[model samples]
Target: RVVGAAKDLPPEGKNYSKRYDSGEDVDRVLELNAGTVERDNINIGDNVVVENL
Candidate 1:
């Protein structure tokens, strides 16, 4: 799971949902675009972490 303040994720036709009453630390679930990931050459198990936006 991610830490720190949340930022606005890219709006590439993505979707989000909150299936449970998660605490402040854990809120919504983000769904990214598969095509975008593929195009970015991000493998199935790649470490696509970012910091400071």
Candidate 2:
């Protein structure tokens, strides 16, 4: 989950935008917040390509 702009994330999820504003390391923050199983699907530091519809 990605939290920010009215989006929802898990309890441990830090506000993505807030993190950005604070210049926190995003991938590391995400990894830290994710559960063990979630980490399997989403590897921090991996390249992610987004497609706009």
Q: Can you write out model 1's per-residue Cα lDDT over 1-53, one digit (the tens) per residue?
A: 42222234455355564233324554434455546654675453344565574
Q: For each candidate in the order shown, give its overall lDDT on alpha carbons.
A: 0.44, 0.38
TM-scores vs. true structure, each candidate: 0.30, 0.27
- As for candidate 2, its clashing pairs are none
TM-score of 1: 0.30
User: For all candidates, what are the clash counts?
Assistant: 0, 0
Against the true structure, candidate 2 reaches a TM-score of 0.27
Model 2's alpha-carbon lDDT is 0.38
User: Which residue window of length 10 is worst by lDDT in model 1?
Assistant: 1-10
The deviation in Å at residue 3 for candidate 1 is 18
Error of 1 at 50 (Å): 3.2
Off by over 4 Å in 2: 1-40
lDDT of 1: 0.44
